[model samples]
Target: MNQAVQYKLKMALTINWFCYIGLLVLFAVWNLFLEGGSIPLWCIQTLPLLLVLPGLMQQRYRSYLWLCFILLLYITTGIVDVMMPTRGWQDGAMLVLSLILFFSAMMSSRWHRLQ
Candidate 1:
């Protein structure tokens, strides 16, 4: 790709990550101080996952790898809850979202292919 195109994509990706983070913060405020819905909590809790896009943008393999480990634990806990049905069906939803977040992050990163 040409430098100009690469620069534009990078900018767009950066803006996207910022939007994700900003949304997460908004969700956090909402969940903690306002609505407190399951979806809001989901967004707040998973907000940290937004870091992966920027990490990918910078080609920070170590950060990406770290988030993968974190994602593993998150997914595992969600799966356990799903199997046991501790917090109702939301557990399964959490698990599914975790998987989606991990998948999304990896895919958004292009699995190191973007660089």
Candidate 2:
């Protein structure tokens, strides 16, 4: 790839990794610590994200593609939560993070293909 393409790919990958890990940490803090959810519930919530970790660590384009799909579920959940009467900042934060994660992951995969 040319320098410009490499730079774009690097930036996308950086944003993708940041948002991906941020979402996971957000879920853990939201469900486990703040919400005081059960261990099983927390595990269930994070399992999908966790499943893609190895591939992500390996910087596999497929993982970034799959992550975009998985993020849709979280995005849906975030939307529902934010619409609720008792919604809090965390709900909005989750929605924003998931959206960012989705786009960044998609871009990352596309840029990866260019490499």
lDDT of the candidates, in the order given: 0.58, 0.87
Q: How far is 9's C-alpha from truth in model 2 (Å)?
A: 1.2
Off by over 4 Å in 2: none
TM-scores, all models, native as reference: 0.48, 0.92
lDDT of 1 by residue, 1-115 (tens): 5676466546544544554455455445545665435765566466656656567567664655566566787688777877883465555655665665565545444534455
**Reference-based lDDT, residue 64, model 1:** 52
Winning model by TM-score: 2
Scored by lDDT, model 1 comes in at 0.58
Error of 1 at 23 (Å): 11
Best-fitting candidate, scored by lDDT: 2
Task: For candidate 2, write residues 17-112 as lDDT tens digits.
Answer: 788778778778878788555778778878999899999999899999999899899899999999999999888988998998899889888888
Q: Give the C-alpha miss distance for residue 16 in model 2, angstroms.
A: 1.4
lDDT of prediction 2: 0.87
Task: For residue 68, give model 2's deviation from the true position in Å.
Answer: 0.7
